[model samples]
Target: MTVILLRHGVSTSNVAHTLAGRSAGIDLTDRGREQAQALVQRLGSLPIEHIVCSPLLRCQRTVAPLADKLGIDVEPDERLLEVDYGDWTGRPLGELISEPLWKVVQRHASAAVFPGGEGLAQVQFRVVSALREHDAALARKHGGEVLWVACTHGDIIKSVIADAYGMHLDLFQRIVVEPASISVVRYTPTAPFVWRVNDTGSDLSTLAPPRDPAARSGPVPGGETGNTVSTDNEGVEHPDSHTE
Candidate 1:
């Protein structure tokens, strides 16, 4: 199963350089709306079977265009919500940087907990758990390779990517998930493959499943001479193949 993590478009809080956290009413900027609409063209043709997003208005707005285009309902998942900045909610980033805890958040995020919010490690756990649950459910329902989207915040996307790479939560800051970008992860029974990260623009047609079922097989040991898609026992595609 393939899960595409999409960060919400630029928000008013983003323009103000503030942490919106779980606050209500933060919306996308005009340019953000344009970015949201562009997703219709970027992902509309893909074989996306389901769409899930953060309950926040920003994420909801981001995936709205694409969901409408694909005629799919958008399901909001709380686990996909932005990090709970708690007391830091709506505070300026510059101001937050001056605090002592800021250093811990940057260099030792696994142990860094917001004054009244959740820890970065907690954020990673919830989001990753949600993703695995959804992936398993979708794979069973589709009974084969499946593609889906999860529209969320930048930090949330970064955390997921870090987990996919088997990196420590403290190093998640090194992964940049820009506003409205898309990162892809293919989950297999054995491991997860990080196909693309923070991809803002590129052709995505290659993500579609091959037309022939026979084309879905594990990669060649030495190298792949042609396109191949690997499938597991349950019919879920594994990222073991090398496409040329």
Candidate 2:
């Protein structure tokens, strides 16, 4: 199955430079709505079978244009929700940077837990597991060949990319996911392939309809999971390169 992970467009909090986290009432900005519409234009041609988005309003607003254009309902999944920032939920980024916990968040995030919310590890587990479950379910539903989109938050998207690359949570800081950016990952029985990361372009015509329909069961001879190919975005095991 092919999963397109997208960060929601910029929100009101984004322009204010505040940590939106899971805070309610944060909606997309006018430019954010335009960005979402641009994303729809970029990916409108793909045969997207499913659209899953975080329960957050920002995410819902981000994918709304695409969902409407494609005539597909957006499935709100809490697992795709933004990380709970706890006390830092609505705090300004400039101020949070001075807090002692900020150092840990920037350096040793694996051990950094929010004052009253989740740790990076906990967030990673929840988001990645949710993605894996959805991928497996879609594979089963579409005969192991499917195209779906997951609209979520920056940190959530980064964590999933880190898991795909098999990198330690401590190194997740090196991975950057910008708002409204799109990343693609394909999971097979044997390995996973990273297609695009934080890409604002790429129509993704090369990803749809399964490169080799039969390869969904296992690695194929001249397809995505094949060892013979050495493309940058080809199948890569974890810990080597987190984002291709």
Candidate 3:
């Protein structure tokens, strides 16, 4: 089966660089919508047989445009949500960077979670578990040739994909999932392999010469407009990220 992982669009929390993990009710920014729409224009043409998302409003809104475009319903899964931030939810990035624990988390970034937040290992276990369940379903349904999409947070999606390739937590920083980015993976129950991880809006290459550099600098015609299409939220995972 082939799985595509996507981060939600920009949210209010993202504006301040705050940790919006598991914080409820946040919505996508206008730019975020444009990004999602761009993704829709890019992938909407694919035979997207399945879609799962985190339940957070940002993720919901992010995927809604695509669902509307594709005429498909998002399958919300709780297990795919962001890891809980504990007391760190809604905290500003500056404050988090100042704390000693945050420093430890940086060094042991993948292992040192917040005081009350879910551990990286645990988060990986559950998220991968959910993924495996889906894989089984897809394998059974399509004989292992199914294409699926799971929209999730930056860290949650990154950790699982990286660990699958023997990458360490400190390496997590290297796999940056810009808001509204897409990561693709192809896996089988027995032998799994990662195809691509965390490709951003800038990575797309489909184009034809319009003979105008100025026009090329802007969003591709009939493509998503690029006006800071990100959102403010946990910058990480969501509870309903399956929105699960």
Candidate 4:
């Protein structure tokens, strides 16, 4: 199964450089609404069977246009919501940077826990588990591979990408998920393939699965020679290059 991770577009908090962190009444900025509309043109061609999104309004608005175009009902999934920043909710990013925990969040996210809020490790676990569960359910429902979208927040998308690369949670900061950007992961029996990350504009039609059923499974003979991003096994499991 393939899951496309889409970050919500720029929000009012984003314009103010604040950590929205599950706060209420946060809406998309004008630019963000435009980006949401653009998603129809960007992803309309893909065979997306389902649309699951964070319950937050920002995420709901982000996927609205595409869902309308596709005529699909958007299902709200709490697990896809943004990180619960607890006391840090509504705090400006600049102010949060001055806190002592900022360093830990950047360098050792696995050990970082927000005061009165959930931990980064906890965020990763829930989001990954939700994705895998959804993937399994979709596969069973379709009786084969399927494509779907998960509209969510930045940190959640980054953590999911980190897991797809088999990287430690501490290294998730190295991955960047821009507002309204799209990342993709294909889960197989052997491993999860990180096909695209932080992709704002590109020919996504290549993601369409081949018509041949037999061509879908197994690895390529020459290790998938083409314009693709993947991990290296050169004494490390992390991605060798950054995905923008």
Candidate with maximal TM-score: 4
Q: Write the per-residue lDDT of candidate 3 for residues 132-244, one digit (tens) a residue.
A: 89878977887536677898887778777776677776666566676787776656444455545555543322222123434334444675433223322334332221121
Those runs of model 3 whose alpha carbons end farther than 4 Å from true positions after fitting are 202-244
Number of clashes found in candidate 4: 0
Look at candidate 4 and tell me the lDDT of residue 74.
Answer: 98
- lDDT, candidates in the order shown: 0.81, 0.79, 0.70, 0.84
lDDT of 1 by residue, 90-165 (tens): 8878788889998898888899899898898998999999999999999899888899999998778888999999
* Model 2 worst lDDT window (10 residues): 235-244
Q: Which 10-residue window of candidate 1 scores lowest in summed lDDT?
A: 235-244
Q: After superposition, how far is residue 38 of candidate 2 from its true place, in Å?
A: 1.0
lDDT, model 2, position 63: 93
Quote the RMSD, in angstroms, for model 1.
8.2
- Global Cα RMSD, each model: 8.2, 5.7, 10.0, 5.8
Q: Which stretches of candidate 4 lie over 4 Å from their true place?
A: 213-215, 218-221, 225-244
TM-scores of the candidates in the order shown: 0.88, 0.87, 0.79, 0.90
Output the lDDT of residue 94, model 4: 78
Put down candidate 4 lDDT per residue, 66-164, tens digits, no spaces.
Answer: 999999999999999899988888887878888999899889999999999999999999999999999999999999889999999988999999998
- How many clashes (backbone N, Cα, C below 3 Å) per candidate? 0, 2, 32, 0
